[model samples]
Target chain A: MTSAEATAHYFKKAARIMDVGERIETLLAAPLREVKVQVSIELDNGEIRTFDGYRVQHDNSRGPMKGGLRYHPEVDSDEVLSLASLMTWKTAVVNLPFGGAKGGIRVDPIGLSSKELERLTRKFVDQIQDIIGPTRDIPAPDVNTNPQVMAWIMDQYSKYHGHSPAVVTGKPIDLYGSRGREAATGRGLLYIAREIARDVGLPVKGTRFAVQGFGNVGSHAARLVHEDGGIIVAVSDVNGGVKNPKGLDVPALFDHARKTGSVKGFGGGVPCGSEELLTCDCDVLIPAALGSVLTRSVAAEVRAKIILEGANAPCTPEADEVFEKKGVLVVPDILANAGGVTVSYFEWVQNLQHVTWDEDRVNTELEKLMREAYERVANISRTRKLPLRTSAYVLAIGRVGKATVLRGI
Target chain B: MLDQLMKLPMCKGLSQGEATELASIARESQAKKGTVLFAQGAHGDSILVVLEGQIEVSMSGQTLAQVGEGSVLGEMSLLGEGGKRTATATVLSDARLLEIDAARFQELLKTSHLAALKVVANLAQVMSKRLLAMNEKLIEGNKGKKEELADFQKILSNWSF
Candidate 1:
């Protein structure tokens, strides 16, 4: 299943656990509003192509909707609705003043030139410009979209009003992007693992960590865990993974992946497939790449004590059940990788105030939020006698429900 | 005819329970003149009958017709497979509406025989008028697009030769 669909599966499971009233169920069944606009763009080929772009504002009960805008041929309103709903739970778990929104165009962005992509992005923004703002709905990056895409969205939105950089996030650092934003998810995983280790009376130093994926999230997580004196015995990427029982040179592996764009053929470690990375023996197994990597089949082979989801919806509902049975501590993605949105929130604030924070301040503030949220989730897990994922969902759902009732929505 | 439909002719053999259900479904909403009530591509769930004032029904933002009190909008969008709002409904003046969800309204048809005939007949008449207008626009739009693409392809063929 795709990550978006996997996310929906997890959401259904979480909803069942929450066992909320019918009112909330009815509210969450479908988006509050789904906007489909004809985004007519004059392509570089001098042909006008009208793309069907959609913005599914899933819910704004807790606050204004916030999520990423994916640009891909497979992006549809249903997928957007799913992702947007996940965002609602995610932001609520992280205690952010936002709900959920997902917007995207049905186009293969890879085929388009930079200029063509720019035109398409601007036109898509123009079509839905009426309902979106910094406070209403904020758009960030997702599959086939990046900082450059966000910059274009912000620029187009600014034209209609003024220099409203806060209208979007996930821009380049030069454009007021947060410090440590790229590695925020990985960094948050390390913090969560450390906090868990401390709670269990295990020394953080020499703790074994197996990270699956060497992209922005995985590589940074490996580095951070390694820096914390943790032994990263295994790491993987799309090409393949590497392992060393003693401890692989994480910095070297990161550099090699950076140079080669894959973890295959790296010296001093054995190669393995993406699936094998999940089952590798380690204290903490971090799935930092794509979603649904940890299905029930692969999860049964996992030997780890904790599974920190660095990637959104990396573990399927079936896999999560297996983890529960195995007494594995499964930290849900919302609570684990919330550092990105937390810093994105900071960036939005900086843009609104026309001031930028130093990298040190940004990292410090992000770390503070991550640590505190980890403690809250951990405490809830202990008090409720539930899994960390369940506790996190409970806390998030309760917060959003209270906010909805307060707003009288 | 429009005003009488809004009043719903309760004296004409309409039962008390049926009248109550109809009134319960009726809701009031305010819109400034020229403000669109339902836009094209919107998920249309309700069929609205204007109780007061008038509205303009437009396809792709161009006015197709004007609908006044007791005139219903969006019956086809509700019953169609996609359930999309095919045309925009803009309030020409302040409007009060008795709107019913298409599904509930359909269910009501199964329960109340008298309501069913009136609703089905009214829906058929509204759809027929809309289809005729839509056919004219489709014919006009198709000719221009074909000629434009044909001219472009001809230029490309000549360049290749």
Candidate 2:
């Protein structure tokens, strides 16, 4: 199934479990707004290029829409819709006062000069400025976008609306961005992993982990886990994979990856295939890369006792079924990777109040929220005898469903 | 005033004698709220360090950064070959500032090599820290550029575009 179809499949399952009526399911499943804009920019070579950009505002029953703006070639309406809907569920799962929205531009940002990139960002903001704002829809960094991009958006937006920092989150710290926002996702994953380990009676001190896709999420999760006494056995990036059963030195690996731009040539571990690293022997397996890596066959071969999803939709429905049969506890992305958005919410609050929070405060508040959400999901899972994924979906669906009904939708 | 200058990051390692001597050459200044310390593109011969309250650095009426106590402003102009202010600095609040004339400071540096070396070293450290911070922001900004480019390339390989 397509990514949008897959998201629908999960939503349908939760709707069935909750016995939510067809009207509510249809209302919740449909996006509130899907905007497609044509972004044309003049390249540095004096050539003009046009690209398709999209913003899918899924739901706003909870609060103003909040999500990221990704820059990629395949950022079509369907993918934006899927991710936007996921954001809706994600926010609800963590009980944040926000709905879901996602947008993306179909361009390879790396190919653009800094000036061109700035112009493109400003133009995109100009197109969607009417639909998005601090109280309307707040955009954060996602995929290929970061603080500087957000800074550009904030700057461009402020030109029209008088110094409004709340229009976007994930801006530079000097631009009123929150501390600890960058590492929020990885830190949130660590919190979830700790909770899961305790529930499964797995001691973190000796637990082995193999992470696929050593980007921000993977690297931070690995480093945090290693600091917490967990043995990170394998880590792979787009370049290649590295493995050491005794635990790869994370700090050294970080330095190597930074220098070489990949973890492939690190001296601390043996080289391994990226695909093989997924099903490698380990206590916890984290797919921190792209989505749909763990299909039926790969899930069947997976030896990890637990799969902590660090990336969005890393497992297809078929793969989830296989993992269910194998008794491999899978923490769904909605909960496992909700940290980024959760902290994005914090950043939004700080901007709205014109107050900045210290890193320690941001982290402490994030831990509290992640832990609380985990406990709620875990309690429901045990009581209902459902998978953690389903329990999370149910909890989120129930919350959203109640809000939808109460809001007289 | 010397004690306050010693507390600033830019004056961290200066000896008491050195700080006192530097303080003698420095002039204490105050600007009320809404006062512009220096306009963008203007020639700047002094570096102002914030002693109390906040100063906003802006360009074309857009506020870029706010430097508070212990933060130095106009260093770029002092260090730049053109010696022209890149951004306008305005007092955000009634503020106390220590203004060090670039020429006077240079004269002090010429007279006392040890003090000069220490000040130069401290300035280098400050510039390095700023450069490192900017580098980090750029890296963070461009974190997924390569991976996303690869994603775009894969799409192109599959499609005729």
By DockQ, who's the top model here? Answer: 1
The 10-residue segment with the lowest total lDDT in model 2 chain A: A16-25
Best by lDDT: 2
- List iRMS for all predictions: 28.4, 19.4
Fraction of true contacts retained by every candidate, in order, equals 0.00, 0.00
Candidate 1: regions farther than 4 A off: A1-18, B1-161
What fraction of native interface contacts does model 1 preserve?
Answer: 0.00
lDDT of 2 at A141: 89
- What are the clashing pairs of model 2? none
What is the Cα root-mean-square deviation between model 2 and the actual structure?
28.4
Off by over 4 Å in 2: B1-161
